[model samples]
Target: MILAIDTATKWTGLALYDGRTLLAETGWHSTNTHTVELAPSVDELLRRTGIQATDLAAVAVAIGPGSYTGLRIGLGFAKGLALANQTRLIGVPTLDIVAASQTYSEGQLVAIAEAGRSRVCAGLYQWRGKKGWQSQEPPIIDSWQNLLDSLDGPVIFAGEINPAAAKLIRAAGKSFQIANAMNSARRAGYLAEIGWQRLRRGWVDDPATLAPIYLRNPAETSA
Candidate 1:
């Protein structure tokens, strides 16, 4: 069984997955209460699932491109639980989880998340039946205009965007689909499922070395 947690943004979620099936799931808009709500949420999820920490095979967490504090809260809690239960830890990128929501597509997939100020964190991906969806390059920290300029063809856009972004996307005249509200936010169950598949394939990382995927340096001004 895998216990997954996502606190990369204001929307926080938790899930219990047993490789092939999701046993339980829960989430709420955190509203800056990550530190206070994380543990209790985990406890409630495990309780509701009738499972204990010791029964978990591993713990998966979304490790950023999001609020610094939110990332820390998730990673810290995940690491603590992994250490206490002697279970493995898997770090899935916040953007990758969002991208996975559209992995079924044959065209380009773009996953964007609101970056504070005026920029957005975006990544481009392509789907292949043999390898599934893979990122084309490192995620970019850019303004909505820059993102539009960089696009080459039809793309599926997923993330939190304002009216301006929506207008720009429409003006570009490129075919695109907006992810539904339920999927606009990261989903822990999806993260856990993907993490488990990767882990089985020997794609594992040291919990101690895991870190958030901040596309831009802290000193850089948001675009």
Candidate 2:
């Protein structure tokens, strides 16, 4: 069994997956409560699914270009769990989780997460047949206007998009398609699936050396 955890932003998600089956999954908009709520939520999922900590063969977590405290809380928890349980640890990028949640599309897909202070951490992506969406480049922190201005052709946008960003996309006209709320909301279920694939291929991270990806200095970040 593999456990997936995502607390990369205000949104937090968790899931229990075992290659062929997704036993349980849950996600919610957590208004700065990740530290307090994450552990209990994981416990509840395990209880409901009748899985013990030892049953987890691997632990997958979203290592982020996200909220400073949020990334630290999630990664710290995941690392501790992996160390104590002696399970493999996998670190999936936060934006990749967003991209993984999206279905295949013909052209470009932009995955984004709120970076606060009027900016977002976004990555450009392209669909790969069986592998799904793959990032074209490393994610960058930028304002919505600059991001939109950089896109020329028809593109699909996914991940956490606030009202103001939505407005800009709408005014930018028909070249863009904003993924619906359901598709855009990052889910740990997809994160688990991705991790399962990696685990099968013997891909895992060292709990001792793995670290969160921060696009901005933690001290300077507002989120």
Candidate 3:
């Protein structure tokens, strides 16, 4: 069984996957409450699912390109759990998890999420059956216009989309222009599935050194 955690944004998530099936899942907008709430949430989720911490054979965490503080809280707990339990550890890329949570679309498929400071983190993705999205490039942090200008084809943008981003895409006037949501927000259950697939391929990471995938320095922390 695998325990998965995702605190990549204000949306924090937790899930338990028993190899072939998802046993339990939960998520909420914690609004930066991760430090105080995550561990307790994990305990409650485990109790609801009738799972003991000792039952976890692996720990899967969404290492982020999103919220710095949230990522730290999540990964810190994941690493601690893995260390104490002696379970396998995996760090699924947060964007890949986001893309995996969505259905595929025609033309170029793009994944994006807010990157703070008015920047959007965008990445190119191709769906892999069972395994989910495989990113073609590292996510880039830029304005919506800059991201749109760099693209030259019909594209389906998934992940985070607000009215402002929708307006920016409409101004591009591409064939498949304007961002309207095609998928719900990302969930840790998808992260668990991807982590499981990676584990099958022998792709575990070292908990001692794993860090969040930060595409841009955090403005609040860096400043």
RMSD of each: 2.3, 1.0, 2.3
Model 1, residue 12: C-alpha shift (Å): 1.3
Candidate with best lDDT? 2
lDDT of 3 by residue, 1-223 (tens): 8999988777788999987899998988786788989999999999998898888878999887777787888899999999998889999887887778666556667877667667777888876776556788888878888888888767877777778887777678785443344365777888888888888889999987898878766655310
TM-scores of all candidate predictions against the true structure: 0.90, 0.97, 0.90
Worst 10 residues of 2 by lDDT: 214-223
Report how far off residue 40 is in candidate 3 (Å).
1.0
TM-score preference between candidates 1 and 2, better one: 2
Tens-digit lDDT track of model 2 for 1-223: 9999999999999999999999999999998888889999999999999999999999999999899999999999999999999999999999999998788777899999989889999999988898788889989999999999999668999999998899999899858989999999999999999899999999999988999999988997765
Which parts of model 2 are misplaced by more than 4 Å?
Answer: none
Steric clash pairs (candidate 2) = none
Q: Candidate 3, residue 14: CA error in Å?
A: 1.0
